[model samples]
Target: MLTWAVRMRRTRQFAWLYATTWRVAIPGMIAFPRKPIGITAHGREVVVPSGLLKLLMKVVLGRATQVFAVSRYTRDVMRDRKVISPQTGVVNWNGLSGDAANWHIRSTSSDDNTQLFTICRLVPRKNVRGAIEAIALLRRQNRLGNCRYIIAGRGEDETALRNLVAQHNLEDVIQLVGYRTDEEVTAYFQSTDVFVHPQIVLKDGADFEGFGLVVAEAMSYGIPVIAGRDGGTADFVQNGQNGILVDGHAIPEIADAIEQLVQSPKRRNQLGSSGRHWVSENLSWSKHAKKILVGLSSA
Candidate 1:
């Protein structure tokens, strides 16, 4: 906003705005993209069709002084929607707040049971169903040894996910433990062996995971991540290097990746160690901030 920018200026602080969604980003240059469906207009909430949303994006981001997206895929989407030009837009990857090892302070699951986990809103775009199907498939085939999959988070799909789990008789294999506190999530990460979240983009491209902070958080704990081959997740998860990337829609592939990790602890350790190193080297709050400052100086 004019006052927001002025306030920062009066305080001699950088006035740049950080945006993860288009709705907020557009107003921020004014205040601050998740489709922005059912938004209020003229004091009445209404759904915004794809065409008009595109036009609004063009008009709104056009006025922005500068825009820093969370990932390269995000910047590309903004460019494709004509929201921001190559000159106005840039990608600044997310980073961890502090040291990696400093995060794992909880004692949990000292047993040999490999705990597979994922924490995200229970949404279709998150592909939690796909993960469930994969777990069910693995259980049916007796591929998973003593491992159990834990989905932590609350969402609209909670009921449906629970139904699917029951349908597969995987009640013992997969447990959907709804919404958890930040501390609880960290404790889950401490006990987690491999993090699986092969998320996807909707066909309309209206909904998708912008960036998977949970994936980075898992990596920080030296846990290997299994994410979708598409979306911003690919920006950080390199296949077979630090983490495994799979087709989110393919349940077989997801099962195969999970089975690979379960069967071979060596592979799991390799990926987890490399993932932690990558997070330490590439992802940090300091690095994220510096990228913005350096880019803003040049812009």
Candidate 2:
């Protein structure tokens, strides 16, 4: 019998031997698998770990019965790294539980002022710092009309983000809220004018936003979104259709998208309406489950 160990005390050689012998080893993450498991060309698995740990994962992934990727981008990265052949993997889009449509009603007519919000772990890949810089650019351009950017959630990058806010003297325009509960997040969505998640692939491509749940959540609440053009967020945003997609690396471009939404409440409402409709129709848990099942069956 093959024993799949999610957690174990073992040396790298032993783990490698076990992986080679096992019929199948499904890892929970492509990054270092603490379960004693688990690349892009810049695959996280290739860049994050070192020495024996990295060597072991390379062997496991190269030999696993099938590799599962959360997004098409991930699957491509695996192929690029030669970790898995094109025919041996599948893409499983993440799904949201419950009826996102029934989550909340659209906020009452937005005023001239805009309340921008983002809910994400403050990590480098999430690029919360870039968003804060964009806010600063807005302030300089005199386009920040009673604009308030509220960032909720905490992470390793929180201190750096807070410093960026303070450095810009934007203590009033940007608020770095600590971690928020799910209920608090829902409330933020209900009140927000636009949601922005400026995610970017890391420099090494070791880390990236596989999928942006916040982008969909805001759309579900009938709020337009401005998201990064890179990674899986494009799977939803249609660039001026359902929402706007911007370059996460370009602070000026991000600021422009925000100002465009702030100045045109009519456009925001239109995109938001379309977004809510599209998300309700395409992002149900049932659809995701069916897709996953089909992939699994074929495998």
Candidate 3:
């Protein structure tokens, strides 16, 4: 039997010993209420007794079968938290299946050469404001010309983000395409030159980016990425190799990375190739499925 737990408390509730191997995978951070456990207990805090939790974990690790994790960050957390033994195997999450029409790579460059793309919900944590600010900064420096920023996604912060764009007089440069179907998103990916994911840590002490699937999608089509070093984004984007990883709040750094990719076609091509190679080897669904199968079979 295998179980996944976000907190030590729940680990105690699902206490069962199995002759078969057991696995416990933690997908995100082990932080407290920052990432809450969905279930509550008796109007009080739900928790596992420490002793029982430890015993169950030992049974899974020692006698059961195999253990697996989702990401290096998660694996490290498990080790540090002593939730799982050091011997547990870790597997990164993989890509989704591509739709037929959206599978082919489109030519990223254009005769006019003036379109950028970003696809993310307009939530504050997504840092859409940062992406817009980067565009504004680039324009102020005269580093950007005739380019349009196409942001496609819908969320609570949509109004605020659009207001920011209009406030900056970026009405012509920024376009909010709103929530798109998967096919539409793939079309946007096909049309754009670069993909940017400017994620930042939230005020609640919660950090995200447990592998940005958009980055992988862009790479599959040979588009380079400019993402923040938020959590697991680093697993896909190697600095100055496959793509650029900027400090989350660094507007100038983001602008500079965008400018570099825009100005050099050769560099963009090289980065795109590197990104595709990395995805095939490390981020593909097939690769991840194979790893999971191996762990499950052994368990």
Candidate 4:
């Protein structure tokens, strides 16, 4: 039955394409493919049809050019699927540009108040609930006072997150400053004490933290991060030295790390400084773009 359904769907797709040849086929055929092109495969796990479509696309599109995967995990997946050969090069994930110098330097001591910031779409896989829970735990123990958490992003889960905040009565402490412009995001990074990314793998085999660009961005601003153990995040965050890596779903561990950073200004400064240095030394977009150009030129 499933086989028949699949065949029927494929037939319908082909029929539609055949019927709309003037509208779809001519334009698709006329477009010239470019080399060193940026192919982003975001959330390739959820949609089987989209994955199949992408696979078919690579069969034709990859013939004359090389491919680059955004994350190491995606690169491995592409390799397993034989989309790109072992000879093809993959670039590690890096963020798009923002105000580079906004948070690169430490401000005066007066601006050092402990504030935790997370910038992500309010989705389940982002583990925003864990961050909120950690804040609640800190507050309950009286370990967190004058500490603020600013979450900047919006999604379908916004209502649920708002409910969780209200249930915990963290309305004042946890502020959901929905969708910020690039400037606003930079401002948050510049002013915040720490950046937290509580990402986690969800059920149905969906994984999160695929080389989180926000974590890297926060690091660029010299903000220490507390990230979950998943995906390619480890490629950037070195636990306990530059940032903290919390074990799976352990709210206590995350809360403890936040509390530790909150109390020790010196440690926070060290971590923040180290993070900035690491980003500068390792993860510049200029370097990645140049490497990509080199690969494409050679290919």
Candidate 5:
């Protein structure tokens, strides 16, 4: 990358280096940043790049021409960590796949059961256990109807989550469907009635949702969302507009949010429709690119 930048500059050409992840941007931060460049765009993915990494980022990343964050939560956290200068960074919310808007808006299901879907690596910060606890709470209250919470993804936390399900006698209601294929993912999204991602900040706020793309995808599929209130998801999920935001550590609130949507298909469709429209208007690769390009040119 250093060689490429040098070569371009030697030929009287401008060099614009952009990395989509921290790993990809490290080399540039080490070799360039302070050097000559037309634009240097780096993404902020880590909640906290600790140790030497944290020190290096704090000192070097601010020297870059531009820094783009996937969400406001990510940008603000990095600022709080002193890893990036608040002035040099901009929040570029992740976009939905093209054609997300063209899908036919799904009608509310009249079936007796509702399908609640969640997809993410099984990690403590994801707070999958919180969702399970909410389900257990619902069951205890006899408010949980014929609903199924389908968790799709595999990671270190899976075993514990499964144990929690069994402990609550919720084995029949919760299923951890490990890693899904692209087709299977699409099918799950299509069939989903509500998307649940009660992610929380963990590891002393070192792990969090930078941007909740899956929530947006579910919304694009016309599925209502129920997300935790602690992360970038708040940027996209307006409490009652597009989705409901609940405290990740509170089981009662999560259960109440779930039960509310489960009982009202009309509410589900309303939130889902508004969410899809939000995605079509604000989230797209083109929109993301335009913002970056505009920022670069303006800067």
Candidate 6:
């Protein structure tokens, strides 16, 4: 509606359309001028065979001056779908909010308890259940000691997840703390030893993790992370460098990744420090905005 109003009144004064998803891009393409730039976060949405949406994307993407994708993975998908000309598509990674990145930096402790954290909606695609399962595997192996798993956020699969926790008898180890305030989330980052976002693409390939921003947020806080290799996370996590990337669906890999960090505080601190630098250099909001301006200039 707002875009339509802008079109009706400000025809001469065009605006850039930053599409958080393809759904938003659809209307933006229709209501905005072709000269203005467009941004999209994921590729699946553009490639989907929705009758009207596909047609709209094909029209706008083919003619747009340029389109920005949040990750190289997304850029590849757009090319594969022929949504945008390969030369016109650019990969501009998503940036971290200033408040989120600098809220609380974790202090290294040699003898402190390890806190495994993941803050995301309780959804199947998020693979929170996989995290829980990995923790359970650790418990069974007697490898987890003084380690607490914190899974925050609420969604439709909460009850089923709670059931999984109960089944594993991880009630004592896993805390399904539903939803948290911004302050609470910051506190978790500060106190957490390792952050894990084990996300996976669903069987039908309909849903998958996009740019794993929370992993970057955790990295910004100087916390080591274990993430999935499915999406844009690969763009940031340099596997065993800044953070560890694993196959989210593989239980052993997730458990092993956590164990590697937990058993060696020295390794954890090393990765955490490197991750902080990476976030500051590449994922900062200020840097992201500047990059967008540069992209616009070139366009």
Estimated TM-score per prediction? Answer: 0.84, 0.81, 0.73, 0.77, 0.90, 0.89
Report the lDDT tens digits of candidate 5 across residue range 63-124: 55667777788778877866766565788877776676476444455577899999999998
lDDT of candidate 6 over 145-193, digit per residue (tens): 6788888999998999999999999888889899899988888888899
- Lowest summed lDDT across 10 adjacent residues in model 4 is found at 15-24
List CA RMSD, all candidates. Answer: 5.9, 6.5, 8.9, 8.8, 2.7, 2.6
Candidate 1 TM-score over all chains jointly = 0.84
Tens-digit lDDT string for candidate 3 (40-76): 0110011122477656554434433444444455445
* Model 2 poorest 10 in a row by lDDT: 15-24
In model 5, the runs with Cα more than 4 Å from the true position are 1-15, 29-47, 103-110
| Model 1: colliding residue pairs | 1-30, 21-33, 22-33, 24-32, 25-32, 26-32, 27-31, 27-32, 28-31, 28-32
lDDT of 6: 0.79
In model 5, the worst 10-residue window by lDDT is: 36-45
lDDT of 4 by residue, 26-145 (tens): 222233223123333433431223465656555543543445555676566556656566665365456546445544553434554578899998888888899899899988888885
Q: Which stretches of candidate 4 lie over 4 Å from their true place?
A: 1-55, 58-64, 80-89, 95-113
Candidate 1 stretches with Cα past 4 Å from truth are: 1-56, 86-88, 105-109
What's the C-alpha lDDT at position 239 in model 6?
A: 91
TM-score: model 4 vs. ground truth: 0.77
Model 6, residue 255: displacement in angstroms? Answer: 0.8
Per-model CA lDDT versus the true structure: 0.75, 0.73, 0.65, 0.69, 0.79, 0.79
User: Whole-model lDDT for model 1 versus the true structure?
Assistant: 0.75
Model 3 stretches astray by more than 4 angstroms: 1-67, 78-89, 96-102, 203-205
Model 2, stretches more than 4 Å misplaced?
A: 1-55, 58-66, 109-111
lDDT of 4 at 82: 60
- Give the clashing residue pairs of candidate 5, or none: none
| Runs with alpha carbons beyond 4 Å of true place in candidate 6 | 7-34, 99-103, 108-111
